[model samples]
Target: MVVLFVVAASVFGLSSEGVRDAVDDVGPLAPLVFIAFSAALTVACVPGPLLAGAAGLLFGTALGTPTAIASATLGATAAALISRRFGASALDELSGRRVTALQDWIAARGFLAVLYARILPAVPYNLVNYAAGLTRVPLAVFAAATAVGCAPRAFAYVALGGSLDDLGSPEAIVAFSVLIGMALVGLLFAARDVRAARAARREG
Candidate 1:
């Protein structure tokens, strides 16, 4: 993993401009290629933020946001399904009353739980996918929540990517500010929800 990160960093340079230049060399098919790569990377536990930024740098906000969202959703869902299939034995071994109750709660509020998880940066995207798979949350609910929850953050990253060349401009400043605000608000809400859930669990 360390070697892979070093290699990727060396090749990609960890900047929107570098990614843009790399994508531009591919011409018209860049979007498709980037989206494909984003999906693959998500499964490999690569952070979605970088891919979102790359999409923005490669395609700009208008095209980039939707592309990033779609690619991310697809990748997360794929990971969940794969984990469900392959990790069933391990999951079965861990099953118990508390686990069943938690699963029931998540299954009942799957969309909201997932939405909050995605909205808050606390939940790592790859980890969330595998976690959801371990529960009984419906795939459709998981997909929907992930799509909705991931949009704001994805947009923020895309915007940042789109504004990379003009970071000093008002557009870039606004984009950065918006992303920060949304992240904070999401974090606050997620914390509140977690507290409430814990209280309820204790009472039960």
Candidate 2:
């Protein structure tokens, strides 16, 4: 599915706008096409916010959030596994201080590490997938964390996107609130992780 999407995306130059056009081209298979294209773009580390907006433009908030979550999880898992298979050995050879420190931190925290990464808006979603691939975290743990941790933000983004025309709508207001809440919670997690990392270094 990913490969197929990639090929179609290559032909269409997939973006949020492009996705809509592509979906229009395939009336009955729009749902599958959306997920496939989104996942492919994600695995390629080529698109982000635009894809969520496309989800809203196509399916509205109710259906868009679930589809976005599904695509994101699938794409993240595929990217991580690809990196694990092909890039881990290469990355493990480099022991740069920052690299080693992050590896140790993530390896120590496992699922929580991924959950934190997913929620923290500052963290790049695609980068974490690749980085986690190089770590000892299990694939199951990675996928589960990605799904759960990303849900809130996914819903928020899709809802906001769906309500783009009516920024003052109830749905838009609620979506903004959700984004703000997630950002605050993510910051708390980040602060805790930083403190823990410092303490661990001192212990070692």
Candidate 3:
């Protein structure tokens, strides 16, 4: 199902340019196409940063950020749902003892776990969604954290996309570095927590 979603998204994205041109030739369909593609990309695990950036690039900030939020939220929700349904086998296969132990710690931390995973870029977005699904994290809390935590990273991409004129310039590099730094900090914290948990587990 995940593979299917990715294939579908790729097909849709490939035709996006033609679709946009068609909408321009016709009328009133441009926004619809943008929303649909954004949603599809999100569901397909194409990466929120890339999607947000594309949204800003295509629509500009005023329209782009809102569109990104809407489409990304929908996509993320759908992906979580799908992961909830088909995640058991894949998760069990991907996660070893260490990962499972880490998940246990996350369950203890609840919303904070979700928050950290959402904030950190080291964790694959799809994997986090699936991992959360496997735990007892409440849907509301999961959605809230995902929505809020995703904003900073998503907005950064959208901002960059909106300013494509500065692509490859020093400012763009600095902006990207800052975003990566923030993500790394969050990841480092999570890593520390994981290490502490492992030590405690070994001791106990």
Which digits, one per residue and each the tens of the lDDT, describe model 3 over residues 1-204?
223423544556533344335546756656567778887877777877777776665665666677777777677667777776787557768889987887678668877778887777677876776567776566677777877777766666666665565447664565577688777888788789899999999999
True-vs-predicted CA distance for residue 177, candidate 3, Å: 5.0
Tell me which residue pairs clash in candidate 1: none
What's the lDDT for all of these models? 0.79, 0.79, 0.69
- Quote the positional error of residue 66 for candidate 2 in Å: 0.4
Q: In angstroms, what RMSD does candidate 2 have relative to the true structure?
A: 6.7
True-structure lDDT of candidate 3? 0.69
User: Could you tell me the TM-score of candidate 1?
Assistant: 0.82
Model 1 agreement with the true structure over 11-70: per-residue lDDT tens digits: 765665666677778888877777788998998888887788767777888889999999
- For model 2, where is the 10-residue window of minimal lDDT? 1-10
TM-score of 3: 0.67
**In candidate 1, what residue range of length 10 has the lowest lDDT sum?**
1-10
User: Candidate 2 at residue 100, lDDT?
Assistant: 79
Off by over 4 Å in 3: 1-33, 87-108, 168-174, 198-204
* lDDT computed for candidate 1: 0.79
Given candidate 1, what's the lDDT at residue 72? 95
Query: Residue 202 lDDT in model 2?
Result: 100
lDDT of 2 at 10: 49
